[model samples]
Target: MLVAAGVVIAALTGSAGCYTDPGYKGRPSDAWIAQLAAPGLDGRLDAAAALGEVLRLQPNAPKVVTALVAALADTSDPVRVAAASAIRHAGRGGGRVREQLQRDAVPAVAALLADSAHPVVRTQAVAVLRDFGPDAAPTSAPALAGALSDPDPFVRRPAAEALGALGEAAQLVAASLARAATRDGDFRVRRAAAHALALVGGPPGTVGPALVGALRDTVELVREAAAEGMGQRGADGLSEWTVPAAAGAGDPMAMLRATATADPNPRVRIAAVTALGLVGDRASRPALRQALADRDATVRREAEHALSALHRRGGQDPGMEEPSRADLCRSNPGGPGC
Candidate 1:
């Protein structure tokens, strides 16, 4: 009986040793927190990673939030990266916890955006700001705008996306976003900037010109994004673009009409057609009609939908003649309008 009891006791001890608690009940153990300050890199890395898991399980813990915020400024880039990423994960928690995490960690994470020595750290920092959503905007926008100039396209892309996530609160940086949309070296950065510009771009006047200009970008994606942004900007956004050719704003309507009817990529044409349908009036019928005959069936389908939308709005104008094909060609020489 004694031998049997010993075996049962040993089995219970072995199972207890093997049992891994999925997470902490409240604050993590002090030993785990101390590991974050351990002398060796591996020890600190492991601790930071473990804390991320802890955050996943106990996302509202103030102690874990404090430890991770401190880790954002750690001596090692990987540790800082892990901390920023962990904070971003934690920002996904329930309402009060997400708000608290953003309030506590935004400044620290925003500071990392300037860590030029480590682009990966900056990238992760923007991601945290991005995940925090609009709440992080007021404090983090300027830093994110600064990141648009980072030498890395990867960093710039997410920074633009983060600013976009901030929505209208990020209006102060509209000019910066405009510059990135029209002039950034990378197509991906340019695309992201254009998408963001549509959201936080303030008024049509501030962002319209840049988005219209982006329609001329060599990359089809950039042009498509520009077209979509114009559509999102609505009537006021397209007001400047739709003026008669003689108004001397360089005939933006003609350009948009040309894009709708003649852009080489069917996706771009579809986007342009959609934009014209949303904002276009009687003057845009010619381009929409031309799109109806596009080689791509999708463009034709979008054109059909656009025409229906136009009819629903009672968009026809008695005074404005549908520009003749010859006139369209004259306004945009060598385009589908021609």
Candidate 2:
């Protein structure tokens, strides 16, 4: 039993030091690029490794990224892997570093994703594409969506994430993602595809009703993500979903209230409450008030906060049984309402 438990623990949560990503060590000299460009193999190898670590830290300098992109072509496998690692780190800032990477590094790194010989090289290259978000969509989405069918869920999961980052521009792969979200054998791939669809095609009229449909997913995380997507796109109206007839009210608020008060998972309930708050309509007050007595303390607290916001918004019944702002502050003390 002890050995079984230990293995489960290690499998679920890897041991320490796993948090630190592998990359080049040491700071880059101003002439680090020149060193990589230098004639000697030793100098170039050392420079590539150091720059890979620097890129792991995500330095936003244009020249540094430009130089790193140049390293992607080096004949040495270490240099190519290190450069890919750095390029992955370099895209976090979302501006010039991202643009430079999109222009110069994406093609090389993406090509490395198919390297066959170096799997980590491919994984690191995929990691780099994650930072590109929507900018890499045109060049990156098709390949990423294609990976959704990979035998390894590990590869499929990150590909879904990158596609999700592409957001609306990932319209081209919406059908593929919808298929993966529902039919994929791996739970992680199903969860990731469900999540990616929320971002890629969840809006009311975009590509399809995949996000709303995800609300019924067997996976708890997928359902939670779907609720969040509905909330984000709910705006002044919840065109993404219609209130279920069983909820007895012909509005999304009815469905939200049902999901909030009755959903089994606390996270889904919390997301439903958050969506109500985001909707910020007077109709939500009754549900928020009902949620005040919810089984989960967090749900109760969230209900209090939502009611407070509703009061502030001049809800349907200011004079009803709703608590005043001061009362809410005392109830959930230290809340933003205070």
Candidate 3:
């Protein structure tokens, strides 16, 4: 049997031991490129592994990148998987090399999301898209958005996560993500979607309600992610939350406060307390103060930070100097205080 399986495993996962073809030792990049087109699965797998090694040493090698991009479409699944893995490795760092891959390889890898028959290949394809982050957003977002509805949760979770990695560029698909967050059968997918909704900056009118609904998920991690997303959206985002009356009466801050005080999970409580600091006004101080007495030390610590933020927003910092009379007079003129 070809060592192609080992190469695929090691390339997909970093834990496997290294595998090298002794015959190709000391071969030049051109030699590996040629071998990629050679007959049989063994030769192609070896070439894919060698090119990945070259990429690790010289990430900017144009010939190696070109060869790998071509290999992504190879008829053999192993070769394609290995090729995607190699491209993923080259994209681990940000610079000219990764930028080149973004322009060259993203579309090809994205095609695999829709065309590949194997779920593993599709999963690896999503991983490559994610490794490119925001740079891959323009080409990869639509494909990734479609992958959210895939039957496999393995693919769905990563697709949601990849969209999250796209950041604000993914706003166009915010509604799709909101649906996944609220209705996905898998909690892992739901958690990833919740986190993505926070980063993707969809219409807060849509995203805010989805996240609030997620707070009631049966899974604690999903609830925790929703609370964290609330904090990430901050005050401006929170202002647009238009949930129905049955769902906290459209008041996200109140919902966060209730979660901080009542959630069974300490991590969820911590996230809720932290969110209050980011979105809450001076009125949130009472809830934060109450959180300071919680059993979990982290929740109490986050509560302290939230209280500090509230104090700073209200201009109550202990080190703040009182406004000067001249300064007040220049601004107020006809008013009692400036």
Could you report the Cα RMSD, in angstroms, for every candidate shown?
12.5, 11.2, 9.6
lDDT tens digits, residue span 63-123, model 2: 6566667776666677766766766667664555555667667766666555555555556
TM-score of 3: 0.78
List the pairs of residues colliding in candidate 2.
Answer: 24-49, 24-53, 88-128
For model 3, give the 10-residue run with minimal summed lDDT: 1-10
TM-score of each: 0.78, 0.67, 0.78
- In model 3, what is the error at residue 77, expressed in angstroms? 1.8
| Leading candidate by TM-score | 3
Clashes of each: 1, 3, 0
| Cα lDDT computed for each candidate against the true fold | 0.74, 0.66, 0.76
Candidate 1 Cα misplacement greater than 4 A, ranges: 1-29, 94-96, 232-247, 250-255, 278-283, 315-338
lDDT, candidate 2, equals 0.66
Candidate 3 residue-wise lDDT, 253-319, digit = tens? 5667888888999999999898888886666777777897999999987887677556546776344
Per-residue lDDT of 252 in model 1: 51
